[model samples]
Target: MKLVKVLCALVLVLMLGQQTVFAAAPAPTPAKANEHSSTMKVTFYSDSLHKEMQLNVYLPPNYDAQEKYPVLYVLHSYKLNEDHWFDTLKMKEQADALIASKKITPMIIVAPRIENSFGVNSSKELGYEEGSGNPGDPGVLNKGMYEDYITKDVITYIDTHFKTIQSRNSRYIGGTSMGGFAALHIGLSNPLLFSKVGGHAPALFVGDMWAPLKNLVYPTDEIRKHNDPLLLAASQKLNKQSIYLDCGDQDDFIAATKQLDKVLKMKKTKSYEFHVIEGGHHDDAYWSSQMENYLMFYGATDHH
Candidate 1:
């Protein structure tokens, strides 16, 4: 009986020792290739909208805490959320490829959800300040002061949390469709915030669209006047560099983009590139094809 009791005690001790050894083992290192690039979703409170908002940030493959990086704010389409560019379009993959190949500079890309706010300080008449619609909802909501949310809240959050090259020259903004329109509006209206602007298939509209817009979001004529990129360009409000406008030749908005291009040329803007690509349409494939161009435009600078 004593011998059996001793043997049982020894077994228990050995098992406990093995468990301790395993517990003390260090975690396995993540693969180096996997460490090169990463994406993170972050949420923060937006004083502009009095709500908590979320955004996805893409860190370059070589992102380093000790180094500062240029930032590009990529807005999403009207119906899509922030992840549209990162997930659906695989924009982060394209960015990773460009950065790894040294075709473009390594930079951080921020995609913020703006819903149908159009990134404008819309009119009080539109009820963008008193509704209960969520971020990606198609209806109007009072919590959709997206311009303020983006320019102030989102930008501030990123700059505070990340090692960013904090300067207008180091920042760029771009988007598609309604997002494209908002990108132009935000960049042009706040030139000191973004040095470069790229509008892909921009939804540039005239007064005829305002009547329909009222039911959609209720924008006052004054808000429309301020958000119009063409008017801003003609009025000399667009003061950013390398403002590129690209649209598919077959895109319905091609005519408006062309007119804007002409206006910019007539204004003799120092740095603007307008291109109507062949066999291009207002769709994901077309935008995806132009991703390289967009990356080049934003990352082809000395800062990059």
Candidate 2:
């Protein structure tokens, strides 16, 4: 009977020791799927656009759902889809490498398929656009309320769905070509929406090359001025916003972009960087080549 009691006591002690060991083990970290970073194509409804809009979202490496992350909204060029950044620009690989090297802080990137609205809240013409029935049929081509679509619906969706920092200081906006034009316009006009605005080969409407496009998008001078980044930068006090502009020296939009650089400098618009890449043109080649610079501007260090 004494021996049996000793064995029971021994078992109890062993059980307690095992429990302690188990308790000491660390709990699994969250967001294991984001260990290497990932991107997903999301098709969501937009009240502003009044149609199903497509977006490409990139979650950075080791993205913890429990942790809030800065958001970078990178718009695509006209006629381009949200996947342009991740697929064509190789943003994923570049971002991955950059984060791995600690060259920039990890961030959540939101790229949306912004149709040809010139990034303005204008008229919604019905034509053959995505989410419209029949590909060859004339569907909703340009949903005019792009400004509302992005600012209201898209931002809200991202904020609610993702673990976003959800602060103006933590937000950034950027684009290429026509998208560049839109990014600058949207970022500068909103002022408080984003901490940084980047435009790669933006169409500032000064040069003859962009004049026609500008005329087509902006119905009146008042509307044009409201959406024009150059005018906004010159007039509005964008707080301490950081503006980034880059274009290939050979690109046609170089002149107007340079003019913007000058205006920003003259205004002493807090902080800004303008670069003219040699042999760079207003194409994916130029934009993709400078992905490093772009990422650095948006996520380099922990500005937030």
Candidate 3:
């Protein structure tokens, strides 16, 4: 009987040990699935154009109606619609992951269609007139009222509808290629509106419009000098504002970006970040991979 009781006690000890081990095995890391369901198509009338523009808004997971989120305005490259930024760049998935991992704070992303205007503001309609002007010139279509669409119309619509933190520090703008150029131009021109700016493989320093077209209404040297980002940064008080610039090392515009970096440094702009990744002029893959880093930088600090 004594031997049997001792054996039973030993068995109980072993069973408890097994239970402890199972408990300590660490819960399986939750599956990293893309489970974003909050999405909507928002339409707002543009008072500037007296027309309606469509935009897609992506809200964070478990979003609460009482909470206000920072706004990220993403502009697309030429020939690409507003959906291109989210679909091609895979931004929705990336944003979900970053928010889940706490790498970046939850924010509202607004993407609007510029309709191939290249984010410019012009008085005439897009595209060239047949013999009346330079009919098939690629530069003619790039000149339009896209800048106003982004800065005035789209922004106004977002502010009036969404529960966004309406302040420069809570707003960020990002884009790629031609859209990248627009981001830089608009961000610098209206510093009171956006406190953060980023560009991927941006077409910076595109020289004068004359180089791209013969009859283009190029800005005068004085106006061009005022609008130049590198030049503008020198005089502007970019307090609490940040800039991120990235481009592929093998990109054709790498040299231009490098020049911009040099100018930033010369002006002692300490708030700027520049990166040259190893790759070519690739598309979504490149932007998707770098999106997290840029978004984190944009939302890292609580300027409010």
Candidate 4:
């Protein structure tokens, strides 16, 4: 069944003539009075894609040229670009508050523009256009190469170009919805890269679209195996890394989150945290409410 779905997706990509699509520009909104971070949009060459990719960097207030700080790689949801969180969610304000209160240590936040590839890259057989409307091929482009970009290109560029703590224990990665899935996959697979991980309303089940599209696809052993984070978490014993997983009770992914929690308990993973909030699958408002909690767990407050 999973193979069939992959085949269908391949056909669709072929018929669609893979191309990039950009989202509509967000409405101009004034930054909050208290928000004082500086942002710069820069482009870098992605060796995996063999093209220049744009990314936004947010530097905290009072940034010093001589002092190095931790880095947080923030990924956005499906159909959204790097500006999704900053423009719509006011992540800068949240970060500012946390920094002012000394809850989360001041750090640089990197947001990359993944376009339509669902944070993935494109390849010859599975080309993807950023912001493309097709939801069938999540990682079709770059041949599911989002993980490589984050770990290799993004991390290397930031560490070399900026004053960053260039170590797993001082670096963190996370996102919401589809981005959350990316965070979980990348963090778990490359435990040596990031010491902390966080996900909010992550699209836990990806390869198996049955839960979302009944007529689209059916579940198979392979599909189930690929889409299960619980299985992924159970297979790895990341004793040094800390994980933060949370979902609103009313979220559509709540059941899957609960199942993952059960699996973590069974595995006796000591460095895991789960939270069930009283909310629904809403917008950045929901995520903003929980931002502080994630920051705290990431040890952004720890001076050591």
- Model 1, CA-based lDDT: 0.81
Clashes of 3: 1
User: Clashing pairs in model 4?
Assistant: 19-129, 105-300, 115-131, 116-130, 116-131, 121-141, 121-142, 122-141, 122-142, 123-142
lDDT of 3 by residue, 62-96 (tens): 66633798999888875576788777888888788
Could you tell me how far off, in angstroms, the CA of residue 39 lies in candidate 3 after the best superposition?
A: 2.4
- Candidate 1 stretches with Cα past 4 Å from truth are 1-34, 123-143, 210-221, 237-240, 268-270, 301-304
Model 3: lDDT of residue 133: 31
C-alpha RMSD of each candidate structure in angstroms? 9.3, 4.6, 9.3, 24.4
> Which should have the higher TM-score, number 2 or number 3?
2
Clashes of 4: 10
Model 4, residue 202: displacement in angstroms?
Answer: 0.5
Q: What digit string (tens of lDDT, one per residue) describes model 2 on residues 122-192?
A: 65653433443344432233636788888999999999999899899999999988789889989998878
Q: Is candidate 2 or candidate 4 better by lDDT?
A: 2
Instruction: Please identify which of the two predictions, 1 or 4, would achieve the higher lDDT against the true structure.
Output: 1
Return the lDDT, model 2, position 278: 95
In the range 1-304, model 1's lDDT, one tens digit per residue, is 9999999999999999999999999999865654578999998998887777889999887576338999999998866789989888889888888887788888989998887777876542334444445544565433246788889999999999998999998999999998898898888888889889889998887545544354333355566566788877777555446699999999989989998898888765448888899989999888988998899998964545
The 10-residue segment with the lowest total lDDT in model 1: 123-132
Better of 1 and 3 by TM-score: 1
RMSD of 2: 4.6
Compared with the true structure, all predictions reach lDDT values of 0.81, 0.83, 0.73, 0.71
